[model samples]
Structure formats: C-alpha cells, structure tokens
Target: MAVTLQSLETKGLPPVNDWHPDFCGDIDMRICSDGHWEYMGSPIGRESMVRLFSTVLRHDDDGHFYLVTPVEKVRIRVDDAPFIAVSVEQISHQHVFTTNVGDKVILNPQHPLRLSDEGAGVPYILVRDRLEARIHRNVYYELVNRAELRMLDGQEQLCITSGDHYYSLGMILEQD
Candidate 1:
C-alpha cells in the first residue's frame, strides 16, 4: 500500500516504545548493511513497507534489535545500525541529516556524531530515541571537509560545530 505523509499523520505510527509486548520469536527479516530490508532472504521492494517497519524497530536493553507492536515483538537481524544517513544539509548553524528511512535529525549535543575506527573510522550519528544512523561514505566525506581542528581536553582534536555545540570527531595524535 502506498503511504503518504497525510496518511501517516492520520493513522499515526504505533507507540512501540511504550509497549511491552511478549517475544514472538525471530522472523526471517534482516536489514542489510547497505540499508536494504529483506524478508525470507529477498529484498522487501516496497519503500512504504520498509518505512512502516522502521517505525516499530527498537533496540532492547540486551542489545538486540526487534520489530515491536502492541502485542508482539519479533527479533530482526541488523548487520549494523538500522538506519543510514544518506544526505546532510546545513541550515543556519545546525547540520541536519536525512536518513534512508526518512528521518530528519539535527546535529546537537543530544544527537552527536561519533567516529569509530573499528573498520576504517566508521561514522554514526544519533537519530532518535537511542537509535543511531550510520553516515554514508559520501556524506561522511562532506562532513570531513567541514571539520576543523580544535583544542580539546589539553589535546588537539578534529571537531565539528553544530547547534552552537562543538562535537569532537576524535583526538589527534602528534607525531614524534
């Protein structure tokens, strides 16, 4: 079924956060690393369905991801973060990120960008309600171009400023 902003607004998304549903066992659904959703090992081709499922996705305290509803909670496999930050826009003093699942997040203290070098310095930004979105390579490059060096905790660091807050990308080491 086609989903529109109007339709979503009228029906509204289920409050998965407030629901403490029982576990309904694992489902053959997976969200690929590239932000594609799959079911029974085949890609879910409908954007609307993906969007709908995204609304119910949650990360439990045990670090497991689940698709939740009022009565059922189904485990789903996520290779990485469930959402991907596909694009970014700078407006005034804030950098806004647009996720593949259609979430708009403003970079601030609450939604900070984090860089981890586990696999060549992957970048992620908090999107909503404790969920994060992996920053796409092209968008990450754009952010790097705008990065500036600043002194942090008595050490030089690469950082970015948004919403009047300075977010440190990571510490910079001086060569001998």
Candidate 2:
C-alpha cells in the first residue's frame, strides 16, 4: 500500500486495532528518545517516510511497539515514546497538540494528558489507541504557565480544562 498523507487522510488508515496480524519478526527500526526514527543505526531523514510509518505504529497489549499493517506486524524498539509533541496551540478552550509525526490531537476525554515518571514526571498525551506522545519540555512549560488552581477531591490542584474536562497537572501546596 502506498502510504501518503493525502491517501491516509482521504482513505483513512488501516484498521490496526481490529486486525490481528501475524508477527513478521523484529526490525532494526527504533524510535529514539528525541523522536527520531532510526533504521539500521541510521536516522530516517525523510519526513514523508517517517510520517507514513508513524501511521502504522502501534503499542500492543503485550507492552511492545510494532509497525502493524493489515497483513503483518513487525516489532520495533522505542527508547521512549514513539512520538513527541513538538508544539501546542490553544483554540478557544481547547488545547491541540501537534506531534513530531504530524498528528494533531486535541485534549479531550478520549485524548487525555498524563504525567509519567520516565523523565522525572514528564507529561504525555494520548494520541491514539495505546499510543502516547511525550510533550516537549517547552510545550510542557507553556502548559504549566497556562494552568490554574482548582479544588479537586477537597485538595488544591493545578489543573487545565479542555473540551469540557478538567485535567490535573499536579497538586498544589497551600502557602502557610
């Protein structure tokens, strides 16, 4: 199948969620910690190719990453996350995250933000089924600057609202 942004946008991606493809052995492709896709110890320089592969990327229930198509699945290595949220933009009350792979996900119930301890509590946002994009440090800082204090579960917390849902960024200590 020819993987192109126009083709994917028009025809949509393959049903990776429902198709249980056979494992086709491991590939020497790795998503580096900085969101660079590397193959055989060399970085994949083609942005189009990277975006195309990102469409087929999946995080399976077995806690492994794979490049999944309708006919086959090939395991790949992910040093951190498969995608990186390089930028963030606010559209009215909604926060939209743009990934390095060219995916834009709005913060909502289905695509929620989470804090992980991988990099001393770095933030992540779900991009699609089982796939997460690590928010870049600058974007995270922007989020933090836009956060507001709110009371949740009777405790003060730093939270942000998007798509009518409140996401707790972290807890806040009361100043004595």
Candidate 3:
C-alpha cells in the first residue's frame, strides 16, 4: 500500500519529552549518513511520512535514537546524525539554519555549534534536547566564508559570531 499523508497521524508533535513509554523492540528503520530515511533496508520515499516521523524521533541518554510515542518506543539505527543542516542564512549577528527535516535552528548558546572529529572535522548544531544536525559541506563553507580570523587561546582561529556567542569553526594552520 502507498503511504499517504492522511494515513499518518495528523496531530501536532506529541509531548515526547514527557512520555515514558515502554520499549517496543528495534525496528529496521535507519536514517542514513546522507540524511535519507530508510525502512527495512529500503528508502522511505515519502517526505510527509518522514517529516511526521521526525517529529516523534528522540535521542535518549542511552545513546540510542528512537521513534517515541505515549504508548511505545522503538529503536532505530542512525549512521550519523538524525538530521542534516542542509542550508544556512545569516541574519545580522545570528545565523539561522535549516535542517533536512525542516527544523529551523538559530545558532546560539542553546543551539550551539560544535566541531566533530569524524568526517574530516565536520561541524554540527544542536537542534533540540541532545539531538544535532550535521552541517553539510556547502553550508559549512558558507559559514567559513563569513567567519573572521581571531586570536583564541594563542592560536589563529576562524570563528563566527551568533548572538552574543563566538563559535570557532576551526584553527588556521600556519603555512610552512
């Protein structure tokens, strides 16, 4: 049967943070590193279905991602981050990020940006709770283009300012 928007829940995002549902075992669902959602080793081609599922997704303290509801919680595999920061826009002193799942996050103290050692020192921004969205290479470059070289900790660093916080993109290596 084809997945339809009407077939999925029409209600707004549930209070997943408040729900204490029982484990419903693992599901063959996977969010690939490229930010594609898959089910049973196949891609979930429905954008609406993916969006609905994204709202209910949660990353628990146990270091596992889950599709949660008031009644049950099912584990899912995430190769990297559950969301990807596909684009970014700079607004005055703040930068607004748009994720693949349509989450708009402002880079600030609450939604701070942090560098990841994996994938050649890629960056990630906190979307909600403990979940983060990996910054796409193109978007990351946009940030770098707007970044300023500052002396931090006695080293030249490329940093970006968002709100009142200064986030370092990375260090600038000296030429030999």
TM-score for all models, in order of appearance: 0.88, 0.88, 0.90
lDDT of 2 by residue, 83-145 (tens): 999998877677888899888788888789998865467788998888999999999888889
Winner of 2 and 3 under lDDT:
3
Q: How much lDDT does candidate 2 score?
A: 0.85
Q: Is candidate 1 or candidate 2 better by lDDT?
A: 2
For all predictions, the C-alpha RMSD in Å is 5.1, 5.1, 7.2
Assess each prediction's global lDDT (C-alpha) against the native: 0.85, 0.85, 0.87
* Winner by lDDT: 3
Clashes of each: 0, 0, 0
- Model 3 ranges with Cα > 4 A deviation: 1-12
Instruction: Please name the candidate that would achieve the greatest TM-score relative to the true structure.
Output: 3
- Candidate 3 per-residue C-alpha lDDT over 1-176 given as tens digits, one digit per residue, 9 for 90 to 100: 11222222233566789988999999999999999999999999999999999999999999999999999999999999999999998765678888998877888787899998765678999988788999999999999999999998898999999877899899898789
Q: In model 2, what is the error at residue 18, expressed in angstroms? A: 2.6
What ranges in model 1 sit over 4 Å off? 1-13, 117-119
Roughly what TM-score does model 1 have, to 2 decimal places? 0.88
| Runs off by more than 4 Å, candidate 2 | 1-11, 117-119, 173-176
For candidate 2, the 10 contiguous residues with the lowest summed lDDT are 1-10
- Residue 75, model 1: lDDT of 98
